[model samples]
Target: MFRLNRLTDYAVVVMARMANDGCKVRTAPQIAEDTGVPLPTVAKVLNALARDGLIVSQRGASGGYRLGAPPERITVAAIIQALEGPIALTACVDGQSGHCESESLCPMRGNWDRVNNAIRGALEGVTLEDMTAGLFVPMGERRSPAALQQASGK
Candidate 1:
């Protein structure tokens, strides 16, 4: 059940679209049209991205939003964290106490830590430029050997 929320997915789509446009200043409507995202949602995502310093917003006529830094400098992890919070599979993995009273005695605590780190590292390996270049893989689209096992029916 691990998955990105709708807003985070939309944010990545918006950013990837912007990067595909050579990282130019794009109006919300333009991005909405290009990415098939709703106008209001695009506005909300843009505002969040700007507030996170991931993008810069311009006002007045002929103004729009553009990347605050080069696309190459922004990682997928940054985008997801901006839209969501820190990437942690479980609260305990992120230094937060779990609802389970026996969290202190959980046998899989270290395993969850390693799992969290592995997932974070995979996301950090992808940049906005990779997204723009169509080299980025969505969570469901990842095709590692372990993932392929499901299809192989092994």
Candidate 2:
């Protein structure tokens, strides 16, 4: 099964919390408390995110971390890439040096790239804003078809 590692999952949770909080800088402890992730894990995830330019960190008594760019500009793919590197499902699709030893003999070589790109594109289409907003509307609040059409500018 294709699955995100625990840390990647935590990173998304952290980011979603941050996005919901707006541009305010948050300490790792604060993020951990809000997200129910462990303090150490949140710190580790924040460090990786900062290093990868997903979040900016400031030092000293009052300093904390904030999203490096607007939430809408940050894609799920970027967050995954920051914590887990490229989103390829297999070594053959990674396009890195010495990724696959059977490249010369494998008949499926290069074919995985198309699938990989498709997955990446899907991830890229989703922004942190969309993620934080979630996939389902509230139970009592359903948009009328006209409202949905208007929202989509159709």
Candidate 3:
């Protein structure tokens, strides 16, 4: 199945934690310790997030990272795209048309594009505020036992 890499997941976790903490400038080591992520990994993710304009960084004694914009304004898709490139299910669906030689005749390309759009829509629909406030759950759906089991590898 298509899934985000562990690095991307960790990036989200780190960002979410920061967002919840009011996006105050935070040291990577501190965020790492609080979030239970490796220090080096947190550093890497912080750099990437800063580079992508999702967060800003300062150096020296009072330096650290904070959200470039308000948490409510940043969508989950922006965070994912900041660390990972565009969210494309199949390579052909990526905006780089030159990547695929079969672009002119690929029958599945349109379908894949539709699916990608749907996924993108859902991700873009969610903001960091939704995450930080524990509003990620949809109104009618509950976390199923199977889903919990899968998440825990039970």
Candidate 4:
């Protein structure tokens, strides 16, 4: 089955959490606590994301990590690529060979690229902001429409 690995899943969660509060520089331990992901795993995920320029890490007491760019500008495809590399379903899709002996003889050669590109395009269309829209409410933001109306005594 085509599914994201556990760490990649954690990365998405971590990223979404960061997106909700993009201004604050968050430490891995704080992120782990917030996202319920383990510390070691969060550290691992953070390092990879930093290396890929998805998140920027800093030092000193006030320094931590924050999104490299606005959440709306960062695509899910970039996140997946950061943690898992390319999105190709098969090695032979993008001129890659030697994984399968019959690669050259395969009838469906090159067709997988279309499939891969479609999936990539879909992922690219979804920004981190898109993924977290309405999923998180900040400190003073109303939780939902009902809550907003209720607060107004509607």
TM-score of each: 0.79, 0.83, 0.80, 0.88
Off by over 4 Å in 2: 94-97, 134-154
lDDT of 2 by residue, 1-154 (tens): 9999999999999998988888898999999998899999999999999998999998888889999999899999999999999899888875554677887888888889899999999999999987776323455888787776666566
Query: What is the C-alpha local distance difference test score of candidate 1?
Result: 0.85
> Model 1 — which ten-residue stretch has the worst lDDT?
130-139
Question: Candidate 1 on 1-154: residue-level lDDT in tens?
Answer: 8899999999989998887676578999999998899999999999889989999989989799998888889999999999998898877775556656788898876567788999999999989886665333466787777655555456
Rank order (by lDDT, best first): 4, 2, 1, 3
Give the per-residue lDDT digits (tens) of candidate 3, residues 1-154: 8889888899888888888778588898889988899999998999889889998998999898888888889999998998889987888774557777888887776678788889999999998877665423454776776775565455
Q: Count the backbone clashes (under 3 Å) in each candidate.
A: 0, 0, 0, 0
- The all-Cα superposition gives candidate 3 an RMSD in Å to the true structure of 7.0
lDDT of 3: 0.83
Candidate whose TM-score is highest: 4
Off by over 4 Å in 1: 134-154
How would you encode candidate 4's per-residue C-alpha lDDT over 1-113 as one tens digit per residue?
Answer: 99989989899999999999877999999999998899999999999999999999999999889999999899999999999999989888787778888887899988999
lDDT of each: 0.85, 0.88, 0.83, 0.90
